[model samples]
Target chain A: MKKIYLALAVFSAVAIVIGSTVLSVSYEPLDEVAERMNLTGENLLGSPFPEYTIPGFPCWAGGIISGLVGGIIVFAIIRLLMKVGEDGGN
Target chain B: MHIPDGYLSNKVWLTCYAISLPIIAFAYIRLKRKMGKMEVPLFSALTATVFALQMVNYPLGPGGTTGHLIGTPMLAIIFGPDAGIVGLSVILFIQALLFGDGGITTYGANTLNMAITASLVSFYSYLLFRRAFKGEKGRVISGGLAGWLGIVSAALLCGLELGLSRATFGYGLNITIPVMGISHAVLGLVEGVITGFAVYAFGKYKPELFSR
Candidate 1:
């Protein structure tokens, strides 16, 4: 089960990388359509990571990185909550 | 479908908030009463997983906007409807406030369509399908169908809301409904497959999770 979880994690990471690449590459045309449709909203679909404006990091990359980091943080919080629950029970 | 702030009219968004708030409150109370302590981690984990999965936006069609997995059905199936509501609400809230994926003003509308409607419809449909069918295959089929149906139902509701907003704005049902309906109908298959596979795998590895 542990091995399976590890494998799934690895697979998800790789998939995220590949998926991000594909989405970034293919995003332009769809973005154009969204702009035309006026779906971009207030900031024109602003980068998820607003603070990190490094030269090398693009918007899509920021989105992908922020998503992954957010997922990890959420998972960590879940673990902490679980621990608290367990402690309370004991 | 992550409807931004400006998409919905004030009346429409306010109406959605009015409808959703009570449901959310009810669900939260029910979850607090019904859920076991041990279930907390699993529930939170699953919710976070759904939140993470929503980030992966698959391109819908040529020059069309992308659609990500809404996992409401899967969450409802694994947890109960109440938990599903809570989970989706949290995810949507975080995404809106932090990421700005959906608009702060339109959060209620998005929650109504994606969380409440999708979860309830999927839960009932899954129960119906599971009862009609038989064993392991039945479970998989039911989950897949529920996932697909849930998405389409949410999409339809979203379309209706968008259409109604046209009275204040200009985008009518003729445009909004057809576009949302068609795109969601196609994208829903992916939801089905993902839900089916996840349910099947869990059924195999952790059958106890669903025994209740």
Candidate 2:
């Protein structure tokens, strides 16, 4: 049962990826799609890219850094609070 | 809100990453220390719940607006803030890498907003309310109330972050915060109800875990 469930989840995920890819392909001239959706923003490289305007940045590098950095800081703050709470308990 | 790629400035994103690394390391250490007998079942349940909750994106308002429950607070109350944070971060990371629900660049920011805030706020709220209400009733009420408050706080924090992004990028913060906050406030309410009920149910069935 668990295996079947896992398989279904995997298949669903793959289907979503494929579906998104196909949607992006069909909507190739994203400008038209953007106009259709009444989206206003800079052109970007994904299905909903135009809907969400591409803000100015070193896009790829910024994304990696954001993921890495934001994850770290939140983790640190959580630890610090835990320490404080423990000290208070003591 | 799942922050898509190309929404934020690169420099700001990197800066967030730089700030997060050491913090994540410290959190990992704490998580290792706190893993006890019930931790596995608790963590497993939380991971499944968070993933399931995030799958249901309710309409916020108007066109192109929707919000999902980022279930960190409920996890924190059950597992303590440190473990909850670590666990949720892992879930977020996996979601980014595999599912692509959120931007790769914004995972750090998202993790901080969802897990950190939810866990801390919910944990403290539960602690405070746990004291006020006595016995079985207290545990259920406190659990539900804490979950609601924690989720709302996370939403507000996310709104604040969005406002900051807009300001830093030369967009109007005034326009962003209201849209973001109001939408998330509704999302938070939904999260609060479900989470509160879940906690209440868990306590009712397994009184030993919640009981003092």
Candidate 3:
């Protein structure tokens, strides 16, 4: 049973790695329209890493890397009001 | 669906942001109060899975459009709604800030749709269906149906938000709602199947995850 679970985990990991190649996207016709509709793009702290900037890197690469940093950062957060922190003590 | 920047008008975005404040507070309290050492691994694994799944987009019919598994339903069903909400919020935040999958300005609206709506809808619906059905077979079926409904609702809401921005977006409910709804209504079936399968696999392999 454990081996099966491990295999499934490994399969999933492989799938994700392969899946990374398909991440770049646009909203299609909706996207074309989004460009034309033209609402103010002003943001206080605009996207530090817009998808447009990264031409070749798969979107998940950003997610996986950011997640490492973000996950560690969130431990501090979870402590006050999330699953890892307040109610669930180490 | 990740609504990018400049899509939602200020009115629409700000309203969602305002509406989310109290919901976040409520979820925050519940999130802090639940889970223990035993629940941590499964919780973390599911969170990672959700993040992973969101990045992969599958084609939506022949329209040249695609969508990903909005994987919160399984999390909500497994760990509870609060965890789903907070967990998804964290993922969406990271996606927006770094990957540009979504917009920081539209973050509130995206969170409202994916995190709060999906979490609450799936959690309660799963409970309702599970109670009605009974047994292991019932659990799997319920998980699938609940997950399907959850994503459909989120998609419809997305359509509505985008449609509402029609004044600014040049696409009203007539255009946006049906397109979003139809695509997701189809996509929701896949969500259901995956949710049901996950429920069955976990129940068979690690029943302990459901105990708390």
Model 3 residue B198 distance off true place after TM-score fit, in angstroms? 1.5
DockQ of each: 0.29, 0.05, 0.32
Q: Would you give me the overall lDDT of model 3?
A: 0.72
**So what's the TM-score on candidate 3?**
0.82
RMSD of 3: 3.8
Q: Which candidate is the best by TM-score?
A: 1
Decoy 2 TM-score against native: 0.65
* Candidate that scores best on DockQ: 3
TM for every model, in the order presented, reads 0.84, 0.65, 0.82
What is the clash count of model 3?
Answer: 1
Stretches of candidate 3 off by over 4 Å are A1-12, A22-48, A52-90
Question: Weakest 10 consecutive residues, lDDT, candidate 2 chain A?
Answer: A22-31
lDDT of 3 by residue, B1-212 (tens): 78877788889999999997688778867665556655655566567666656655666633666667888898888878988888788778777876576788789999999999999999899989988988999989999999998898888898899999976667898988887778788867878888898777777777776765
Ordered from best to worst TM-score, the candidate numbers read 1, 3, 2
lDDT minimum window of 10 residues, candidate 3 chain B = B53-62
The CAPRI quality class of candidate 3 comes to acceptable
Scored against the native two-chain complex, candidate 3 gets a DockQ of: 0.32
